[model samples]
Target chain A: VEFGGLRAHCPEAALHAARAAYLAGCQATSNVEAGSRFGIPVSGTMAHSWVMAHMDELTAFARYTAVHGARSILLIDTYDTVAAARLIVSAGLRPAAVRVDSGDLAGLSAAVRAVLDAGSLQETKILVSGDLDEHRVAALVASGAPIDGFGVGTAVTTSADAPSLSGVYKLVAVERESGMVPLAKLSPGKRTVPGEKQVWRVARSGETQRDVVATADELGPPGGVPLLRRLMRRGVPTESAPALDAIRDRCRTAVAALPDGVRRLTDAERFPVELSPDLDRLSRRVGGRDDQGP
Target chain B: VEFGGLRAHCPEAALHAARAAYLAGCQATSNVEAGSRFGIPVSGTMAHSWVMAHMDELTAFARYTAVHGARSILLIDTYDTVAAARLIVSAGLRPAAVRVDSGDLAGLSAAVRAVLDAGSLQETKILVSGDLDEHRVAALVASGAPIDGFGVGTAVTTSADAPSLSGVYKLVAVERESGMVPLAKLSPGKRTVPGEKQVWRVARSGETQRDVVATADELGPPGGVPLLRRLMRRGVPTESAPALDAIRDRCRTAVAALPDGVRRLTDAERFPVELSPDLDRLSRRVGGRDDQGP
Candidate 1:
């Protein structure tokens, strides 16, 4: 959403929704067109840029809402966010939500909700989006900030905490005149398995742990099933993937199941992934035990 | 051209071309085409990826140059760089240059250059590409490393040292019934001057230190000119951007007279960039001042 600039420097949940609604307008045609192909949701939200573009906060809200409709989300923090919330509630038009991008979001949320309830607009949602990743989101939910959604940016795009994924694109197998041949790379410190690969993630009855990976052409099967599902083949989508709400729910589920090791904030333990005997044998053979590769 | 793949990663003397004759075929056409469009240079050198791809250093070199031709740059630090250099020099068409991605590049460059010279391949250039940016390049050049070019990546793309420029597309001015009206985003910690704006750079009479900057509208007649140039117009490129070589030269020239402030690696001085009197007047009216523009 950040890379797509759906929401940026947003100040209130109302603004978040407003931005998202605005982006929906811009991306609606494209999303409809893309639905015929990959079928993915195009998302966004109103950013502080809109506020800066208008002469005054009231004018910005009125202009955005007039053009975008009551599906609007008003930003509550360009000036005194509490004061602006009063202005928003008095408007009487149902807003998609209110946004809190700065200050103590919890406190502001409570105050804003109280005011909204007093004004009889109890259905309005609250959203938060400022430097939030899974952990922060978890903390916010745990603390009961009333935030219903997020608009993550820099963190999502840059993946700043762990910038580079260890996932590497390598030529594990090569097709010769006869058949496919497996390959591997082994340097002083860098080592990789050779040949086509497969990963079987073994999970406990509930908790996720005890995963074992083996080469696709292994003699014995591993404890779990295949991890690599065919995502795309020959530039075609394998499945419709899923709807936006469904994907978001999956994200919630995945994040909820993350173990303490995987979720730790600092000096944390890493999730263990072991290779099976068959995969080890194949790796050693393809990579060569004696020499550090070629 | 350091960002470019083929601009003599050893730092060419600033070129407008990475002309490959029929003797060479660059990477997947888009890589070269994009380079041409962005004025980036296509660079190549043998790395463990290729070595492991072929599972043999010699095979990797042969295949790479077979496609890339006379520009083949072989990675020599697989096991022993010097030993591999000897092998590369002896077995087949001597590599155009042997790269030492790891270890002391300066020392390795000397030894590699000497070896190549002794073997009568002076045409072979020693190109190095490890973690190098402009500073490192300047340092190597100052120390007289016999390196021919540099293939700088991460630093330039990521702008590692100073990640993102404090760049913002702002609403500087807007058309109104009463002449053009200046605008501003008077948010706390984020105050921008309003209206259609220009940045003028006034260099000292003889030195590189820019003396002053006046908005285009504020420039007094033609005697004391405007310092800023219209870098972009109507969200489009108005001027032909310089080639990588020329851009690099401009960078050198610009940095050379940077007035000892913003150039420091540590507790350095902050370059003085004062606003024009008209700017100050406008800012005062808008209740804003730019210590930095974000």
Candidate 2:
């Protein structure tokens, strides 16, 4: 998500963005205490390239700390996890985290933890990262092995299960000379509900929700307002837009409100999306039953 | 792959990149022509979102064609592809291509082709695309269907066979006052070959040859020179770098040259990468042995 390799990247933009979010700036090792206040975790891990560039594990740790900060997790499995852990402890940097990138997560975690305990360094944390997803994270935690936060990358960036978002925009209701005409596309099984649309959610007791589609000129169901509110007007963020924390909270609520079926990992039924009569009529007028259009 | 959405997006960088690559700039319709000129087949399929946006396949076709050119394929199965093919032909456009994004490839292709032939527009090519890879392509071609080209997206992007490249760059030789020193990393199982490496690949005596690696400073076995010519130096493409077409040809050659074992569809023996004795000696000085600095 961070535009690391873009042109005109000064490295200061990362620092500034972090600061604006009231989070730690880049390579700010002393700001671990700021974690509680900012709620943004200080994190990074050893790349295979870095491990190979430096000759030895100890030298790699020394150089990494010199460049990044003292809190750098010495990558244990560059060759052997247990052996590297022993060397890292011997170096006396206190080894904030011992990361295992590849290999059996449960077995490696158990063995590494044992090695740390055997060395009497109880403070070292275990961080596991490599192709981890929410499902995998839940599974790993369920296994009763001790591990801290995840370093999710490509899967998150790519959203592998659903890479492309189907979010779309259309001229649902365009201003016209005679009257405000409601427009819609009625393409076989791909017919769209017509008019400037508003989606209202009817929540029965508990976490259940039913979505209703209505015309822009009319009010929707008695309860929830439209989920797709104006995010921007004429190419600028609106002042009332929620802050990141608030947005995260809203997201938590939205995801939580899902009635289980929609959130399932497999074949899931879509939530109901019934339309108002006026919108349905407008759709019929524009889309057509036969191939004829007028 | 195609943005598909027609929103009034601002002149942002990401959108610009997409616009440059896919939208309206020498847009490729068919593969043979695209491959001949572009050197890479620029291809795509009609997304379901587009199908769903419009009502009735014919109306959808009219709207999409009114905006984009008529040279594009008609996605038939948004409702029922075979039926839609009749409508498209009746509409007099006689589409250049008819895409079937889903359903039984063999059965559907045969049925649709039968229907299209009954209408006497056999030249209206049938292009099938849905989760196709090299294996599926080979199979479909073997089955003797009339697919013009492929619209490879997910498998190509993800590199499903080998998700991530195991390529690692290491500082093999750093200069010292005494002599050029070689470095090696010995972290557990991660033992690296030493030396500022030159990967010299010697082809075994034939057009279809297996390659062996050698040090750049050393002569190749029999007659292999060097493969590790600097691809990029001081942020410039090397003169040795071929044109796009030539590079594609070379890729075809190298891929063809891959040993039958390496090309197999399973866990295979890795290509051998050799190290020189001088580099090994330097590695010993740096990290070849156990224990820390003397």
Candidate 3:
């Protein structure tokens, strides 16, 4: 994934986004800091400016290939996609890939592919990118376009549709003279579940089931695996952090175990998360709704 | 403007956004880094979690006021806004301001204002913030809501509607053995105008009329003011950077000098920007369109 868009926000945000992208199974990233920090492979293609800097497009491709050898990924859409591909092949230059940053990606990729094949440069891959989002990538893949890779930036890094996370920290409990008292906001449209809680993921025979949110002291249901662990205590880490690759592996495994319906990109089925009986009763008591409950 | 949203993007983005906000006349920011870097005042209100951590809303307000004195900006929407305001008055605590983070801001601010005024705490100001954009702030002002200040966050910092800038560095000229030669890209929908250029802002009296883009060596039209200046020479500073306050003043003057139509928040009239005769000729020649032009 190309992380150039990350530089438009904040360094902390870029770091977090790079880590999240890695955890989500992004094979390589264009973010050098992320590569060094997380041990992810760093990869990138040439920019259109590189091609424009030289006297002509063909000369630019040749110079880049001579310096970077077979690792060079020439950007071919500076003037024309098909013409650039033909020129590269005609000059006997073999770049690892050619990226099309604009135009009708699927159609241009097919046309470029044909030209490359005609010149016997079949090994050169076609990469496409330009304001690409999840939906666009899916459509391109569905169209069977001969695209070798996607260099996504803006959509993934900025999260254009949902730009900011709505996560908030709430005080679930406050220590009092009596030890500890559970607290819950009665604010309209902003209520919080009171007290410490634990989430138990119930899976049976390799098929995942629903999650149960119960009070921290409650016992887990049958075949339920606890999902929460103490990461820090009293401003200090409780244990050494897991390696990035190990965390990525766990993320991949967890995502693969999800049901097909819940894993869909669009119209995804909501993953069921139920409140345990004890937790439901506690919620009722804290919310002053116990009069209506047994 | 609260710059918390800037943290969601990148440090460079945050710095640029903070500078832009300062230039656009933002009085203060919640970003301490921005404040120290740009000389903008740092200001912020308490979080809901602060109120939630206390035994009750009244106690939280009392403690916050006791510590911060009249400078305290108490968050009043934890459980109930009006109730919290009334509680503060009844308990004889006078905070500098009360901030409402959610609900119908106009109605709540009016209600809270009435409660504060009736209790003779007329000096206390009212601030409101909750996913507020320019439109919402303008609407609140138009409705004559008794709000004293705004704590905008997401919309301004993230530019929710237009998340990213489409700026590009193009190769406009190349130096060779024969001297400098201008170049222009013929890329579809991404053409460059070619060569160094100067932007001249034409103004009459105190009102900005239009802008003219001319070739660098071309003479400016009568009453035209050059907008670009050299900032660096051979990787060294050409001149000391202007003070932040001076830049802010310049920005204010420039914005105020714009025509009313062009300054409107919605349906803003596009500022006219015409190409000068010499630049037009250069463009035509570089684009190989001289055959069609006089």
Report the TM-score of candidate 3, chain B only.
0.94
Real contacts recovered, all predictions:
0.19, 0.14, 0.46
- Minimum summed lDDT over a 10-residue window in model 2 chain B is located at B2-11
Off by over 4 Å in 3: A1-8, A11-16, A204-209, A289-294, B1-19, B289-294
Candidate topping lDDT = 3
lDDT per residue for candidate 1 within B180-230, as digits (tens), equals 666665545656665444555555653444444444466542334354667
Model 1 residue A244 CA deviation (Å) reads: 6.5
Task: Indicate the residue-level lDDT of A75 in model 2.
Answer: 77
lDDT, candidate 3, B1-294, per-residue tens: 564543346556666677777688877887788888878888777777788777677777888888889899999997778988989999999888999988889999999999999999999999888878789999999999999999877676676666655566777777766766667766678778877889999999889999999988889989999998789889999889889889989899999999999999899999999999998888778788332112
Which model is ahead, 2 or 3, in terms of TM-score?
A: 3
lDDT of 2 by residue, A1-294 (tens): 111211111223233334333321222211233344445445556666676555456887888878767577777776667888888767776767878876777788888888888887778889876666667767888898878655543343233454333354544544445565555543344455656777777776647477777766677777766766777889998866456466556666776778899887557779777877767776676676442223
Using TM-score, rank the candidates from best to worst: 3, 1, 2
Candidate 1 lDDT by residue in tens digits, A1-294:
333232222223223333333233212211222333333444434666676556566777778788767567776665466777788777665677777666676777788888888888888777666656657766777787666666554443333443222344556767655577676554444456766767776656655675677778664343466767788999998888566456556566655665778867666778888888877887777655453333
Greater-lDDT candidate between 2 and 3:
3
